[model samples]
Target: TKMDKHNLTVLNEFILMGITDRPELQAPLFGLFLIVYMISVVGNMGIIILTKMDSKLQTPMYFFLRHLAITDLGYSTVVGPKMLVNFVVDENTISYYFCATQLAFFTVFITSELFILSAMSYDRSVAMCNPLLYTVIMSQRTCWMLVAIPYLYRTIVSLLITIKIFNLCFCGYSVIRHFYCDGLPLVSLLCSNTHEIELIILILAAFDFILSLLIVLVSYLLILAAILRMNSAEGRHKAFSTCGSHLTVVVVFYGTLSFMYLQPKSSHSFDTDKMASIFYTLVIPVLNPLIYSLRNKDVKYALHRTLGALCNIFSQSSVYHVFH
Candidate 1:
């Protein structure tokens, strides 16, 4: 154990070869991602603020949505700034402990998000299938539990995996091919046999993926059945509208993730993986708030109400200052 611990410190740091290696492309790419990161931060933050401020949004759907926005903001914050810095700098180095920390937090947020989406799906199913008992079934206490369990579960899982990955002996070469310190990329750098670590990553990823996806699939199926049985065209249309934004989000998030992680190892390319990672890490966060705000009339109304209230407050303050 002592020797293994000693060996772990052999590689003091890792150099992150970012999204692109082309000399000319770095600055333009940097500018592009800067805009993306800004949009993501603003969009997710707006969702969070709107959900908190609007009485109309004080429902289970918005409750789940608020957490989803938090996670989108969390993981993006973890990866975006550092990657942006790397884009402009000469040496894209991350220290041993810092890399481990990045991996851990990234894992927690990403995994928690996966389960949260599933929870949202289940919430939708209840709303559609058992409208009478929806409130009773998804009470404030229940919503808190649904959100809490995922964060706790993912924290423990991230801790164990981070410890396991860092415990392995890395060869002299400490260059990671991806933008962020991802598990598989780190595992690939090990001088020791990587079979066990690789297996652990694969098993955990597969399990999380399948389990959460099953929840979503089953939930949507129930919603579909409920929708089909509706006697009125208006009711059916309303049901579809209620589920549309969430369904779109689920499809985009899961589709990018599945393409990135579910493929055979033989087909794995770091470049291709980087593209998929960008879609989720940067693109999805921007897309989510836009998707929800644009699709849901409730959110749009909340935004207008919130802006009106702010404007009134500003005008009143200006008038007071002018008189003083």
Candidate 2:
């Protein structure tokens, strides 16, 4: 038991070398990320609330969007608070177990978001290509199944990956070069052979990217064909408009992800990786809700109506107070 405890203490914690070590940059970066995190949380929460409360947003598309917001919120919260703390703290250290937990949750949410986007694309395709049977095809039961599968699948995958990574022998070196505990950075710290784990990470990353991207591409192709077949100019425009927000989101998400993880190892720079990670993990979450809400008329309308209703309630309460 004493020997076991000694071994555990040896790998007790990790120093997270955050975005920058410059004293001058710390406060500014903290302020910037703080604002970014706040907006991300509020925006994603607004999307979830709007989808839930607005009958107009009760369709299958909004259902997927609600889950997307949730995953965005999930991963952002997992990383953001710890990161902000690291900026100001004398030591940006995370405990061994805490790092593993962060990696696990980050993996789960990021992977789930990818598949959820794929599901959303499929929803768009069904709505556009098979308008007549859209409701029947994307029924409530079917919608729930699509989202449930990703969450369940990713949870298992993340746990396995986390367990495998943590099981490696981390000795002497404990400073993670990046802001958070990412797979590659952790792998690099292992004094033991990293070949098998490297291969596994590479395979999993490739599989996730290719599979999800393929779904999005095929769905868009189908949607494109359906749009061309429509005789009405207005109909084509409406179809394209409905698809635009989702397309923008997919492009930004996948593009940044591919650039970050799919690069050759020789070309990898921790600084560059940190920037890319910041974009997807923090910036994108804030962008998704804006992209969806501002671009989609239905979402915009629902937001206005919701705001209007709240205003009415507040105004009525004020009048009642004045009378009393």
**TM-score, every prediction:** 0.97, 0.96
Tens digit of lDDT per residue, candidate 1, span 83-141?
99988999899999999999999999998999999999999999999999999999999
Q: Ten residues in a row with the worst lDDT in model 1? A: 1-10
C-alpha lDDT (0 to 100) for residue 275 of candidate 1: 97
Best by lDDT: 1
Q: After TM-score superposition, what is the CA distance of residue 191 in candidate 1 from its true location, in Å? A: 1.3
**Candidate 1: regions farther than 4 A off:** 1-9
Score residue 122 of candidate 2 by CA lDDT: 97
lDDT of 1: 0.94
